[model samples]
Structures are given as C-alpha cells and as structure tokens.
Target: MFLAQSFVFSLLAITGLALPSNEGVKHNNMARSTKYAPKEPPLTTPWTDKVGTKPWPEYPRPLLQRSDWKNLNGIWKYQNASDLNAVDSPPFGKDLAQEVLIPSCIESGLSGIQTDWGLYSWFSTSFDVSSEWKNDKVLLNFGAVDYEATVFVNGQKAGFHRGGYYRFALDVTEHVKFDQSNELLVFVHDPTDDGDYVIPIGKQTLRPSHIFYTPCSGIWQSVWLEAAPTNYITQLDLDANMDGQVNVTVHSSANGTSAQAKVTVHKDGKTVATHEGPTNKPFQFTVSSPKLWSPDSPNLYNVTVSLDKDEVESYIGFRTISRGVIDGVERPLLNGEFIFMFGTLDQGYWPDGLYTPPNHEAMVYDLKVLKDLGFNMVRKHIKVETDLFYRACDEIGLLVIQDMPSLRPLQSVLPDAKQQAEFARQLDVLVNQFKSYPSIAIWVIYNEGWGQITDTYPEFELTDRVRQLDPTRLVDSTTGWVDHGAGDFSDNHHYANPQCGTPFYSTASSPYDPSRIGFQGEFGGIGNNVSIEHLWNNQAAIDTINQTYEIDTTIEAWNYRSHLLLGELEDQIRLFACSGGVWTQTTDVEGEVNGLITYDRRVSRVDEKQWKADIQALYDAAAARSSNSTRDSL
Candidate 1:
C-alpha cells in the first residue's frame, strides 16, 4: 500500500513479464494501416457473432448498484484516425474501419482493430436512459478504461479518468440528456512501457516477453450506471480483530441514517453462529468458535449490511491476519492459528481477451481451477484485478497477497523526490478499496524492488508508506532482498528455483543473516506444457501437423518430470521454515511456458492427484515442525 526506500541500490535484471496493451512503440498511435502481425486464435464463444454484440453486459459496479442502466456495449462506429476532429459528424451511422469488441483491449484479437498501439483512439456508443433514471440519478461507470479516458454524454462532456488498471465512475446524471438517446464517447491515450506513477505499469510492452503478454487498454472492464438516493452507502470496510470481534466501518453521504449488519457463520451446511448489530461507526460482534477462515477449510460467515430502513444491502466477511511469535519463530497467524500460504503469482491474463476476460464465467473458471488444484492463496503480483475477482476469492476461500502494481520511477535507484508522495496517494486509495475483503492476507509493498533499488540494510523500501496506510496487515518491504529492516516478512523470488532462503532465525547463525520469516514470494517455474494445450491458437490447429509444430507433439507424449518439478519445488516450498509461497503463476502466458494450465484453461499439465499429495505433505511437514518446536521448548 506504500513505498519504502530503505536499502541501498542493488544490481539485478527483472524484465520479461506480462504485457499490457500499447505494445512496442515510440508513440502509442497506430493510425496507419499496417498488416496485423501473427496473432493468437479467435475466442471460442457460445454466442453467435453479430453486430451490436459484446460480451460482459452486466452492470459493472456491485457496491453502488443501480437497475435502470443502459448498456453502451454493442457495436459502435469507429475510425483509425489519429485526431478526434477528423470526423466532425457524430461519427455514428458511418462506415467503420473494423468492428472492435467492447471491454476488450484494442490490441486483443477479440477487438477486430488490432494495432501495435493507439495513443489516440475513440470509442463511441449511444443509448437511451429511461425516464425513471432521469428522475433519480445516473452515473456512467467504466469498470476500467486503460491509460486515460474522456467521457461525453449526450453531446455534453461528462468526465475523464487515468490509470488503466483501476475502475472509476462518472456522475453524468446532469450532463446526460433526459428523453433522447445519450451519446457516450471515450478517447484513450495509453503508453505502456512509458512508465508513469499515476498508474502502476505492469509488464505491459509493445512486445511482450517471458511472463508478460500484450498490454490492455481502453475499458478492459464492465461499464454501467447506478441510481442512488441523495444519501446512500458510500463505502463499507470490514475490520476483523484478533479478539474474534468483527467491526464494520460504514461511510455514507448522509448520517443519522442508522445501519445494522446481519452476520451468519457457516461450515458444511451447519449454522455455527449468527449476529446482528447496529453498524453505526464500527459496530462489534463475535463469532462463537469463529470457524476461522483459512486456505485449507476457508470457513466463512456471510454478512449483509442494510441501512436503517433496510434499504441498501452490502456483503462482507469477518477475518483477521496478524504476525506473532509461534514457539520461538515468528509467523503469520490467520484468525488465531498459523497456516503457511502457498500458491502462484497469478498474473490474471487471458489468451483472446488479453486485459479483459471473455466473460465473468471465464473469470470464475480461473479461480475455480486454483481451488481444484488445492491452492489456498494467490499472490497478485504487480497488478490489481476487478473487485469481482476479490469477491470471488472471499466466497471461495482463497487467501490473497495483493501487490500494488508499481509505477516505474524515472530512475531505478533511490526514491523519487517528486513521485514518492504521488505514489503514496495512489497507494492510499488502493488500500482503502480492497481492505474489507477477508481473503486478502497480506499487502506486498514492492516486487523484487521494482521502482526503488534497495539491495542493502536499512532500505527505504516504501514499507514506511505502506505501514502508514495499512499497519494492520503485515507488509513485505521488498519481494527479493532489498531488506531495509522495514517489512514483517523477508520476501524473495527465485525462478526455476532449486533452493529457498534460510529460516528467519538462521539469518544470523547461518550465512543468510537476521531476517523475519522467509517466504518463497516467487519461485517454482518449470516449463511443462500439456499436449496440444493450446498455448497459442494458430493456423497449425487447422492445417496438417508440420514438424515445425514440434512443441505440441512433444507435449502430447509429455511425461511430467514429476520428480524434478515437485521434488525440487517441495524442497523450496519448505525452506527457511517457509511461512508462505507465491509460486510463479497459475497459467502459461505467450512465451512463458511455466504455468500449471494453458491460457485457454482447457488442460492440466501436471498430475492433479500427485501435485495435491505433494502440497499436503508440505502442510503435514509444517504441522510436524510446529509440534516439534513445541516439544523442544519444554
């Protein structure tokens, strides 16, 4: 949630990751007609292709919801023109260069307009708002529009937003015309590799590498409107303390309007406990035998918050995370017990959809896979996802170590005197938005010291800023060794890793030195693809099996190097009395053939039963260690 520049400079190369839209370019403007380069396969959808048809049609915002909203998602007229003034006319009913899908990045295959980049491109759509919406209120919401966006509602200007990764809403209720069809226009300018602080740029490149795929831009999420009373639920923050007491923090435009939270604890169809309270300024309640939420069991209680009059309804969870000394070593305790979190660094990328998932069902599919694979946690490395993803994590019981995407500073050395404060501001909004979810276990400050190079002691690794924003959650100052004596855990990332860092205590006795609990923040990348798993869709799928497509044929008869992949990974996942793990990734991206599943989400490369057994063994080992430590103390 914040930046720390505690340590001195370190020399390391960390390129070759996921790519956003706005691919390779001096300028992100591909107005000229250039032949489309080799692309992936077309997305296979149940729906028949037609005009005015785009996937992801639900009202995007679940928090501030409205029913009387028109979807501006269908087909819209467009031109690959550089400037906005070229076509003076509304640009409607005019011939278009090619139909591009909404909620998908322009660079993606789903969006017909595949260009290297578009610093200047316009998205226009028109819809009629019901008179009901006119009477109450209207808000135009873009689940997220990449880079920069400007809105024009019904010939009148509305608002604009930057930051391609986060979501935003504009109250166009006033600017929108009442009776007539409203015109909504968006102009986006996204520079991917051109790192900026306002938006933390991920592995977005004009040309994608190792883990990075193509960059996504211009509304990769859902967009809709909401109508609310003059006084409505502004925000809800769920705070679960170690006392087993849960506090609900509600913020609204109007006060004196009472609020109560109805909570129900559940496990295997048995109602454990239920509580309801006047959720006025952090109401507190306790769960009996509080079926603590964890990766293994993920026991969760349902919470429904209603206004004084039972007007608006919102849902949250009751869970707490804290760091405490267990036996002699310190470890992260969930709810009350210590459980080691181990999982992949989910990049949240799709083959055809790129930035956006084909649909919500597809989005859920990814999480469900993680569950099936016996993963209790996921480290969202260097990127953020829609709240819906977090919501699913809450309901499904996946612990998240969310990393705020880093804004690449001008210099890679110390903290930027100018950008430091700005990064802090963005970090504040990020923490406030996702703090309530029960699945989020830790807040990661930096990934391998991305922006600030802190290779030595007392590193100013942005942990100070992160702590100020969210001291509740344990902070990992820097993923790798930019140790500045800041973070709660000494995080590290090792690719194709054979060994893990020494235990926190061993840092002094051993060569590693004094450190907190060590985690395999990143490790375990073994290139093992399934036969015809479809890493990239291509003409080869239709044509004869040429020897050139050797990878697929090789994988068809692929015997997983189980001993090498897991024997080594198991050893790594157990190192330094490892408290948690953020495995490389869940699925394979463009070039990085190091995912458990392919991009299409079809095949499982590894043996499920065998993998689970290995993971379970790790847990058993930890349990045994905890027991041994207890015995030795006596």
Candidate 2:
C-alpha cells in the first residue's frame, strides 16, 4: 500500500538510512516547548480497570535492590498555586480547587490537574510504615523531582534536593509517625528550559511541533519510602572481566572507617553465589565462564548486600567493557572485542507523559524495542531518566551514553564567569548523582551548541570536572558539534551521514587527546515520515486527514520501507569498521522524523533483514577480534 513517492523513498531508504542530520535546523519555535508535550502511551495504564494495581511497587531499584520499600505512588492531593507563597492551608483543605494525580506531572492530563501558569504546585500523601520496619530506619525516596524540591514528613521539612534527574533520600525516622499514618508533602518548581538551571532538556517546548514537545514540569518521577538500618549502602559501581571475576567499590554512608560487606549473587529468586569482605579490601567473586551480559543476553546476577551494620540488596553483570586498539584504531572493546555501539539519540519524551513516562512499562519498552530491532546503546540525549530506566538498561544489557541535562538559555554551554562557577557546582552534583551506575560508560558534557559558546575552553573545564569525579568510565566532553580537546572520547554529531571526523580520530589530541576513544556521538537522521499513526501527525495538527493513509506507511509498510534505510546505514556503518558509530537514535522523538522505529514503538521503519544485516556487519567489523569468534567472522 505504498504510494509512488513513498515507494521511491522506500527504495532509497533501503540502499541506506543515509540522510545526514548535521544540517543545522532553522532556529525556530519548535525548541521552545518541545519537552512540554505529553509523549507516548504506556503498556500499562493506572487509569484502566483492565489491569489490577500497577506492579511497579516492587522496589524500583533492582540493582541496589531492596525488597522492603513502601511505594507511595498511587493517589495524592495536588494543587497549583500562583506562587510558593500561597493561601495559608494544607492541601486538600477547602482552599484548594482540585485534585491531581500522583507520579504524573501537574501539566500532564493523566495527572488530573493541568495548570496554566507555571506556579507553585503541592503534593501531599500519607501512609503508615509497616510494623516490621519499626526498628529499621525509615527513608523517604524520590526517584526524581523536576528542578527544586523540598520534602516534608509530618509537616516538618526533613531535607531538600535541587537536581530533578537523580534520586534523593531523606532519613524520616525522626519526622514520621511510626504508629500512626505519616503525612508527606513535596513542593517542586521546574523552570524547564526557561529557567536558568543546568538541566539537560532536549526539544521541550511550550507548544509542541516537529522536534519539540511539552516541558516536564513539577515532580515527574516517582515517590516512595524504604527501610534501612542506621548504616546503609549508598552506591555500588560494579565492573567485571572476561575471566569471570567481578569487582565492586561500595560507597556507603559511613566513610573512613573499616567496614565489612556481604555480597550475594542470585539467579531467578535463588542465591547461586555470595561474596563477603571488608570495604577496605576489594570485594571479589569468580564465576565459571558465566553468561556474559550483552544487549541481547542481559544476564544479571542479583546481589544482596549486608554492610557491617546494614543489609541491602543490588545486582551485577559479569561483563567487561574496555578500550584498546582495534585494527590500529582505538574503540570500545566489549568482552575483549570491539562492538560498535549502534545507538540512538534518545531524547526521552512522551506525548502524554512529557519527561515522566505514562507507565513503568513505557519506561522499559524503548530499550526492549530498540534491542529487539538491533541496537546496543542509547545516548540518553540531554535528560536523565529514573532509576527504573537505568535499572532496565542494566538488567537488559543496553549500554548507556548518559548525558547530564544541560543548563538553559542555550548560553550555559559557555558559562559566564558567574555561571562558570555555578557550572562546576552543578557538574559536581551531577557526577556524584549517577557516577556509580555501571551501564553509564560515557559521560557526555554539552549536546551540540545549545549551551556551548566558548568552544574548547569550556569543554576542557567540563571534561576536567568529570574526570575528577570518576576516573573509571569514559567521558564524551560534548555530544554534538563542539570539541573540547579533553575527555575520554573524540565524539561528534553528524546528521544524515556517518563519520567520526577521522582527521581527529588518531593524534594525541586527534580523538581529543589521542589517548581517548573515538565515537560517532550523533548521526544518521534521514527521515521519511509516514503521516499515519504518527504521534504528531502533520495533517492532524493542521486539522486535516483523519482518514486511513492510502499509502499506508504503517509499521508494516514502513518496515518494508526500512530495507532501503538499513542498507544505507549498513554501508555507512561498514565504512568505519574499526571505528564505531552511535546511530541517531533508537526511537523517534518529535519532528526530526528519522528513527529505526516509531515513537510509540508500534512501528518499525527498518526492514528486519536489512537492519540485522547492517548491524551484524558493524558488529563483525568491530568485534572481529572478540571472545565470540563467530561474531568476528560474520
């Protein structure tokens, strides 16, 4: 059911997904409110009775996994006031006008409370801690809050957090009523894009169109509670090697003092391994030629941890990620071989959820869909995701290119003297937040030129900050057009075509100090839009066709259309066998309409054969010298 022009495009796309993306977009309205739009639907809906209660309550963090956390997710009282200084009264009193949904932002429809003015919104909830956790410390957990947030337990401010992307905790043992229902109130303010904070907001707009959507305002992540002993583990950065030995540096609340840690590994629900040691010593364990973790085979070993006086749980994968000379060019070596990170520029957005995913399943669906279609990594463009998203990637074996949400006004990239100092403060905060996540192998500083101005100087400053934060993982100083001549990777963003800017790939500073790795951070955005079933339909937006597409560029048709794109992508990918390319993205976002798959994930544009062939070729070329000899020979 493909029309002539679409068919022609299909043929061309089959030859390759070669349309370049580097062409600078006409600076226009799209960028203004892109992140403001509600994104895609969820695999599960809390609104519907078709399914029972959403099962996400099972402790969101499966890595530093916990079995005894309380999910404060469902219902809550929310109201948006003109400003923080509002009518004097607790929410749900006669003073408030309406009720809002929990977990969904006030700007979202599902939230049951969408506000016009970016005002001060308040959320209040109450729950009783289980009697079993009485002796244990009660900790309030917020997966994320938009910009600035102050948390109160029993009407008393326990603690406050500023960054909206990373999770934060408050020891509410003193504030919560153990025997009675304890009330929790959270106040959030997100000056999304408009406000001058260093959040990495990509394509968020006040009015959505093309590549821009709605901005995620207010509390966009999850809220919950957990029970921990006086001493609990904070972060666990796990690393492994092909020989089957794993290493971990457990960051706990108590530092400088000698500590003991008991690590247990699990499969399914049963414990298959265990490791106990002193924090002063490296916690080591050996598995016999274990199933290595990969995008396809996301094998994870559960870890139940017991710190000297604390008992916590987490997980680990016995896989090794390294960088060495492959065919004379330096690239990432996974399990001792080069595995080209064919990925997407995932500006995690939703038509319905904005920054907050409509459902937990929606959160994990993109990675599963992309992995199914053939992709190993996702450059989490700009915005940072919840712990669940990272948990999904870690468990499912999807590599992450985690970018710190950039600051706004698009001028923060070249921070002024005043802002430059603030930049360090913010960067330091960001690094301390997610540095421990193992899947985050690369830390991207600025994306394109949005916030960047003073070319390499700002970049080097930023790069130096990241290296100072965590020395293990690699750093991509900037993801797009600018090069800092610092960081761990010579990264670049080229649209419509694939290239690592080979000229900069080899010298001591060629790949940004020659000692670093070279990566195609962004490229391959040749878009052939299928009008039908699009999240943002041009016809619908202009108030036109609701009729069925005669051309039917539906998933089936588009998948058929993929043959051309895949072949082209394959050819481009093959050109740099040794050097790797991170494809434009895993899923479609807004109007910059080129994706191997659709935004909703219901449609796949790349034909399966062509997609696999191109991917296999890239994998073969890059991983020809890996432990998986078959992959190398392919």
Model 2: what TM-score? 0.79
Report the lDDT tens digits of candidate 1 across residue range 1-634.
0012101100010133333333222222334322222123333322112212556776564543444566766555334555445324334333334446676777765565545565567676677777776555576777777777767776665776766767776767787677686767666777666533334666666555454456777667777766655545566666665456766666654667655555554445565556665544666667555555566555555545545333343444555677765666667777656777878878887766676676778788878888887788888877788878887888788888888777553334344556555555666667877777778878876666556544443235456666665666777766665555567776656544433445332231222323476566776665554345464533322132221112333433332443354465456444444676666668776665667776667766767777788677767656654653432110
What are the lDDT figures for the candidates, one per model?
0.60, 0.61
Instruction: Give per-residue lDDT, candidate 1, residue 492.
Output: 57
- Per-residue lDDT of candidate 2, residues 1-634 (tens digit): 2124333433444466553221222222132211112222322133222112232454766567666777877656554544555424434222233344556666554554444234466666678987788788888887777767877777677887876676787888988776687877777766555544444455554555445555667766667788888677877766655677877777776667758787777878877767777764457778676777777677777677788667677666666666776444566766766667877778886644556676667777778777776777888887787777877888777789877767553453345666556655766776776665557767777766566765446778778778766765667776655565666576655544444635434221233334456567765655555545554433323232222122233556544544544454455444543255666666666454566666656666766776777677667645444433322210
lDDT of 1 at 1: 9
